[model samples]
Target: MKNARPLPSYLVQRYHGWKATTHAENKAWYRRLAEEGQRPRAMIISCCDSRIHVTSIFGADEGEFFIHRNIAGLVPPYAPDGDHHGTSAALEYAVTVLKVANLLVVGHSNCGGIRGCHDMCAGLAPQLEEKTSFIGRWMDLLRPSYERQAGIADETERLRAMEKEAVLVSIENLMTFPFVQAAVESESLTLHGLWNDIGEGVVECYDPDSARFLPV
Candidate 1:
C-alpha cells in the first residue's frame, strides 16, 4: 500500500501552466543567468512557510534576489560548529561571494515556527529530549526572546511581541559575522526588517525613526 498522498489536482494543473510560462522565458533568462552569473542586488532571509513566498511577496523574478528560507526565519548567532550551518552558509555565499548590497530579514505574522516556540515555552508541548526534532532545535534559537517575555500574561500580545523581537534578534546575530559587520561599518551593506501580515495582505516595515512597525 502506498503511504504517499496524491498531488492536489489544482497543483498539477498549476504545474502545467508554470511550465508554459517558464519555457517561454527560460531560454533567454536561464542562459543569461548561467553565462553572466547571478548578480542579485539583495539577499532575503525568510521563513520556509509555503504561504510566505518571498519572491511572490516582493514581485521578484528569478535571479533577482538571493533567498534563504529557514524555520521561523531565525538567524542564530555566529558559532563555528561542525554541524551543517544552512542559513549561515547561505549568508556567507550571498554577502562574501555574491556581494549583495542589501540584506532583508522578512518576518511574517502567524508563523508556525514562532507559534511552536510559544507553545513549547508555555508547557503546552512536549519537553525536548535526546530525540528532539529539527524544529525543536531550531526553535531553541529563540529561547532568549522566550525567556525575556515569560512574565507576560497575555498570550496574543506575547506571540506578537515574540515575532517582532525574533526579527530584531536575527538582525543582531547577522552582525556577529565579521564580514557582515565590516560591510555595515563601511556602509557597503544595509539591513532591513520587514513584517508581512498574511491574513490582511498588509506589509509593515520597521521604522527606525519611530522605533515601531508601520504599514508600508
Candidate 2:
C-alpha cells in the first residue's frame, strides 16, 4: 500500500470527463444498479488482452454481465484442493450464487498465452517451461490443445486453430465442475465458445455440428 501512488494525471482528467458526461447521464441507472445489486445474465470468461472488451463487443450495459478475464481465457478443471482457485471460484459463484443463465468463453487471435503454450510445448520457449513461472504452470492446461494442433504445417493456421482450441478446451474444462454439469443438464445453464480476430473485427462461434468456428 505504501508503494501505491495517486491516479495518473491523464487518468484523473479522463475520470472527470467520464463523471461529467457518461456517469452524469446514467446517474439513475447507476443508482438503481447500486441498490438492486447485480443479477447478471451471463458470465463471460475472456482473455486478459486489453484489446478484447466483452461489453463493447456485446453492446452490453453495466450489470448485464459477470466477466472474468485471465491469460488465454483458460479455465482449469474443477479441483477443490484447498489452494487458491480464482477462475474456478468465479465460475462457482456465477453458476450457484448468481445463477447466471449462460457461461461463455471467449478466445482471441494472436493470444500471447496461447502462443507461449504452443512454443513451450514445442520446446521453443524455455522461459515458459521453467518450473518457477506461474504462467508456464497455468498454460499447462492447454498442452493437450497444443498437441492436437502441433502437426499443422502452416504456422498462421495453426496459431488460429490454437486460439479457437483454447475456447473449446475451456468449455470442456467447465463441464468438469459437477454443479456446472448438473445445471447444464437440467437446462438451467448453457455453455458457449467464441473466438475473435482482433484486427479484422470478426467474431466466430464454435459450430459443434461441423466442429468449426463459423463467423458470428
Best by lDDT: 2
Question: Cα lDDT of model 1 overall?
Answer: 0.88
Give all TM-scores, in the order shown: 0.89, 0.98
As a whole number from 0 to 100, the lDDT of residue 119 in candidate 2 is 88
Error of model 2, residue 84, in angstroms:
0.5
CA RMSD, predictions in order: 2.9, 0.8
Q: Which stretches of candidate 2 lie over 4 Å from their true place?
A: none
Error of 1 at 86 (Å): 0.6
The reply for model 1, stretches above 4 Å from the true place, is 1-16, 127-131
RMSD of 2: 0.8
Cα lDDT of model 2 by residue, 1-216, tens digit: 899999999999999999999999999999999998999999999999999999999999999999999999999998999999999999999999999999999999999999899889989999988899999999999898888997999988998999998899899899999999999999999999999999999999999999999999
lDDT of 1 at 68: 93
Give the whole-model CA lDDT for all candidates, comma-separated: 0.88, 0.94
